[model samples]
Target: QQQVKQSPQSLIVQKGGISIINCAYENTAFDYFPWYQQFPGKGPALLIAIRPDVSEKKEGRFTISFNKSAKQFSLHIMDSQPGDSATYFCAASMSSGYSTLTFGKGTMLLVSP
Candidate 1:
């Protein structure tokens, strides 16, 4: 079973500010951490991800950091903008074999213009 906890159900960030979201899991079997970004009426898209073997991964303005010892990870959005407002979900899954993803409740991010 996957027990993942995500914090700060919602967040407000000003344009050009940085947005941070955190997540912690209790399952060591999880090997992959993927952050999904969802818009009002669209499916969630993979924003960034990090594997257990790596400490962090950065893509454009997004970043994901992993802490294997703590079983925690976080997503950071640099230079936040009004268009970046969306719901972010932190998920965990096994990279190998067949496994379903365990997702946190999700964090609603709002960036003001």
Candidate 2:
């Protein structure tokens, strides 16, 4: 119930296209769902997030579509860009004190020019 599973360890999307990645978890106790985007040798930054209470969340060109009953969520990058190429991670964590996140193996996105 603590694992977040992601697919397509790597992906190549042309610039101006859309990049999609999927993830699922088993833990119903988890309250926060966040996606982090990381560049080489850099720490992951929170891109966008959605609580279980919400069905979806969007930030600029990034969007998160969540499915509560299916225990799944996905990240959609609209208008993929070379600069958007990075390692994306899906994570889950409980709201309680000191809850560390469980991250997916990671999906490397490559946006070609």
Candidate 3:
């Protein structure tokens, strides 16, 4: 079984600031790194992802980075708002197999005005 380790159990960011969460994996076979966002009452949804071949991927205010050599990845939320506050999770899985994601402990982010 593979594992993903995440840092900073919780975080607080001011509005328009940047919030970053990091994760490290020990499985070299994992090829996909994704970040999931979960709001107060909703289930987690994919926010952004990066492949081992790419160094980074960005969408809107979200960015995901992949470091194949280090077997690590990260998520960066830019211009963060209170609405963006959520429980973020870092996950890894093999693209070819069933999407059984190995998730991290999750990071609770609070964006304050």
Instruction: Name the top lDDT candidate.
Output: 2
The clash tally of candidate 2 reads: 0
- Clashing residue pairs in all predictions, respectively, total 0, 0, 0
Give the per-residue lDDT of model 2 (tens digit) for 1-113: 43899988999999999999999999889889999999999999989988988888999999999999999999999999999999999999998899889999999999999
TM-scores for all candidates: the values are 0.96, 0.96, 0.95
Encode model 3's per-residue lDDT on 1-113: one tens digit a residue.
Answer: 53899988999999999999999999888888888899888999988888898898989989887788888888999999999989999998999958789999999999999
- For each candidate, the alpha-carbon lDDT, in order, equals 0.93, 0.94, 0.90
lDDT score, candidate 1, position 29: 89
What TM-score should be assigned to candidate 2? 0.96
Off by over 4 Å in 1: none
Comparison by TM-score, 2 against 3, better one: 2
Q: What TM-score does candidate 1 get on C-alpha atoms?
A: 0.96
Query: After best superposition, candidate 3 residue 19: deviation in angstroms?
Result: 0.4
